[model samples]
Target: MEFLEAFFGVIGDLTWGWALIPFLVVIGVFFTVVSGFVQLQYFGRMFRVLSSKNQSGDPNAISARAALLLSVGGRVGGGNIAGVAVAISLGGPGAIFWMWAIALVGMATSLIECSLAQLFKRSEGDGTYRGGPARSIIHGLGADYRWLAIIYSVCLIASFAFGFNAFQGNTVAGAAEESLGISRIWTGILLTGVTGLIVFGGIQRIAKVADVIVPIMAVGYIAMSLVVIALNITEVPGLIYSIVTNAFGFEEVVGGGMGAALAQGLRRGLFSNEAGLGSAPNVAATADVRHPISQGITQSFSVFIDTMIICTCTAFIILLSDVYQPGAEGVDGIVLTQQSLASHLGGWTSYFLTGAILLFAFSSIIYNYYLGENALTFMTSSPLALQGLRIAVMALVFIGATAPSATSVFFFSDPMMGILAVVNLLALMMLFPTAKRILNDFRAQIKAGVDRPVLNPDQFPDLDLDRTAWTGKIRENG
Candidate 1:
């Protein structure tokens, strides 16, 4: 375990220090500029597109709405809660400023990647669709990039399935133990059982459960946070000021400095919203949409919803209260969040937080499972391989639950995420032209005064696409 920690720590430092961080900021900025600031222009349009029906009318495939819910289920989990706490503890209030910055840029990044996913998506004739950075490489860039595709598939499975999923399990188990005196192993078993049930049911079923539960739990948690915010409304202005100034302030430099602030903020923001990180695009590809860019725009809204709203809510809950401190030794992660909220609203909120973590983590585990399963489909279509993946996911959930702490799980997972991001971001860079073309197509159709923009695969003769997926404008009221 010590060796594993050392290995991951070394790799994490190298990746964040030299590569992923710069790449993230650069590509995010590039896409945001290249897209003509699409994430902002169609802000209202994203919701309209989200609320609209699946015009493709493919019953077997997932809807744009379900895809949003599923992706949100994955994005708005322990990371938003526990992960935000860690960022504040390590980097202070300033980290929140950086988080907001990355998320804003990442909104454009998510739009491009997810739109590319939809544009290059292939149908299986069973209403199931497969696309991601990997599929984009295969069909969009041709077979020569299969090696990069394989690396992406492996990294996606490693990061989301085994690594991040384990952390979620560890968090849920810890929360259960902290709040209810439940044995971690018992919690592990329970998570495994529930995870197996939903993951084995497949993605659409995952959507069925997520649509109902994720919104309620998320809203409840956010509403509770709003109560805390309201209670401390007077302190809110000073807190926001601190967040911005400390982002590059001198005292902060003397303390932990801007580097730690930027690192943790970008890392956690990516984990929370998953915009440019390439995770959400897999879910986006499954949606049945009249225009691929509509799903892209809709998914972009999710990044804002996750980081700008939900994560900010968690940040405010800690910063507005008396609980958080800069560079606090050994007071980080989920415990800090629980303690802060407990202080604000009393002890019973611990139980409430525990319940919320279960909902968030459970939904995330299934979402993670679907992503890994999608990666498997990219590598192979064998049922036995997928079943093996299911069992492996269940086993990891148990193991992660029984683990001693979340830090170990994070150390192992964070580096894996860095690798995956590099691969996916490279694909995004290479496929930038394709994404831009798709975005232009959507913009042109909307300019033509069409109420709902639709893709004509015939128009994109230079690009390879599955024409069967886009027949015409979305069906009436669909």
Candidate 2:
């Protein structure tokens, strides 16, 4: 186990530090430029789309808003909390600035990939739609690129189910043990059991659950964070100053200099908001939006909320407390946030955040499970295979809970996430021409005074897409 962890850690470090970082930044910048800064162009429209109805009246099809919530729930987890702590501990306050930078670019990257996913989405013929980078690759690019799609699916499964979900379980277990004195093994078992119950119920059920949980937990956490920040409001100006300075101030940072800040910020930011990593599109495609851009723009908001709002909240929570030393390399992950919150509020805040961790991490576990399950469908449709995967997911949750460290889980996940981002970004680049056309069609209609713009299949005759999905119509449900 130690050897595997060490080996993967080295590979993960190399992948993110050397290959993926620059690649992510360049591609994200490219997408942002080519999309005409769509993230900003449609920033107001993002809110407007959230109020629109689902085009498909099919009972099983999710609304764009539900998809947004699920994506947010998936995004808001150990990564937002523990990952942010880890970044600050290892990189310094400057890492927060880098995280903001990545999200700025990632917002556009997400818009492009998710919009393409909807354009190339497939109807499951069971009142469901599905798509992602893999769907975009195979359908948009053709059979010759089927191999690439398969590889994307494999890496997504590895990242979400095997790697990301384990980290979720590990964080939850660690928090439970530290705060409430629960045995890690017992925490693991309880988590696995609860996870199994939800995952087996399928994505629709998961969406319903997310609709309720995501808003509640997110608001609760943010409200608590607001209290902490308000109590220490005077320190915020200096906190922001340090975040800027340590981002470039070599002498004040614990983790050496700008190098650590950039790496951890990009890696952890990608993990948290997931703008370009290609996981959210799976759920985004499931939304029966009138136009692909509707979901795409709304999905971009997830990155803003995850990194800019939620992650920044966690950072403020930590930095506002006396427990956090700017130059000292102390705790990371849930423990640091929990302890810091406790210091600011009271000892009870530790237990409060333990519940937050459970909810946050559990949402991600199921979200990752669904992504893995979605990926497996590209490989095989066998019930037995999916069952086997569920078993493995459960087992992994247990192992992560009982494991002594999250290092192995995180190390393995980092490389897998880098791989997913690489493949998905490549596919997005290849499919950009088609994506541009699809997005343009939406822009033209909206500018022409169409209150609720929809995709017209006839307009996109050259592209092969599910007619059911691009019907150029929306049902007005009063």
Candidate 3:
């Protein structure tokens, strides 16, 4: 395990350097521009679609709100809180600016990939939706790319099972031990039990739990952090100043210089939203909205809420509390976050943070399982294969609980996510035209006084809807 981890670490570092970051940026930027910045144009529509309840006869995958809830459940987790702390500790408060920048582009990336996923999502015998790069690769790029899709599936499954799920569990246990006196074993047992109960219930169950819990936990944490900021309101401007100026290396931050700040910021931001990494789109494709782009727009807002709103709140809590001065040794991971909050809210805050971490970790475990399950379906449709995969996933969740080192959690996670991002970005580039056409048509209809948004893949003669269109659009204005 040591040898393998080291190898993955080296590879991950090499890819994570200038090569992958620029590649992700370029692809995201291209799509953002190509779609005429749909993230901005249709931003209001996202809320409208998410807020509206679906009628009983909607033939879509899941309710728009449910899909948003699930996607929110997946992205808004330990990464937002703990990961933000790690960014500040390693890269300084300056990292927060770059995180916001990445998320800005990441929203565009989310829109593109999610639209593509909807284009090719499958309706299984169980009456649920499953899609991602694997489905898009096969549907758009043809069978020749099926091999590429298989490789992607294997890597995605490995990422979620060994990297994401394990890391989420370990973070919960680590936070518990550091903040409270609980052992990792006890933490893992509690988490594993919670995960088992929710995961077995599938998307509807997961979404229901998320719809209630995600908003409450997120708003609660942010509210506490807001009080902390109010207590130290004087420092807010300086913190913002530090984040923006330091983003371009105008001022020296932690480690050597600007490079460290950029790396730390991008790493934390990417992990927080999992935008270009392609994981969210798996859940996004399952939405019950009338059009894939509708769900796509809603999900784009989710990325913003996860990284910009929630993660930023956590960052402000830490910086405002002044937990780390320039010359002081930094706190690590969730412990640092717990300490920061404790400073504002006292010891009881630590226990609440621990519980929040557990919720974050548990929801992520179920979501990670869904991603892996979809990947398995992309590779093979065999029921036995799926059954075996479920059992294996559950067993790994148990294994994740017992893993002692957070370092090991990161070692497994970083590389697999990098690989998944590369594959997803590649698919997004190929399907950009489809995304563009849909955005244009949707916006044009709204401009022409069409109250309802209709996107029929079959109606588009020039574009092969079968290849890239997800939902059947309304035939006429009612």
On TM-score, the leading prediction is 1
Return the TM-score for each candidate structure: 0.94, 0.93, 0.91
Clashes of 3: 2
lDDT of 2 by residue, 1-478 (tens): 7998788777777767678768878988998898899999888877754454443466787777778888899989877888898898888888999999999999998888888888888888776788888888888899898999888898899888888788778888888887789999899889999888888888788888888889889999999999999999999999898888878764456746888887778878977888778899998888877788878888999889899999999999987887776545556677788889999999988778888888898888888998998899878989999999999999889889989575364566767777788888788888888888878888888799986678888887778788976676665510
Q: In model 3, what are the clashing residue pairs, if there are any?
A: 62-288, 456-473
Model 3, global lDDT: 0.76
Rank by lDDT (best first): 1, 2, 3
Give the least accurate 10-residue stretch of model 2, judged by summed lDDT. Answer: 48-57
Candidate RMSDs in Å, in order, are 2.4, 2.6, 3.0
- Residue 242 of model 2, lDDT score: 85
Cα-based lDDT at residue 207, candidate 1? 78
Q: Show pairs that collide, candidate 2.
A: 94-247
Count of residue pairs whose backbone atoms collide, per candidate? 0, 1, 2
C-alpha positional error of residue 111 in candidate 3 after TM-score superposition, expressed in Å: 0.5
Candidate 2 Cα outliers beyond 4 Å, as residue runs: 1-14, 49-57, 248-251, 403-411
The 10 consecutive residues of candidate 1 with the worst lDDT sum are 49-58
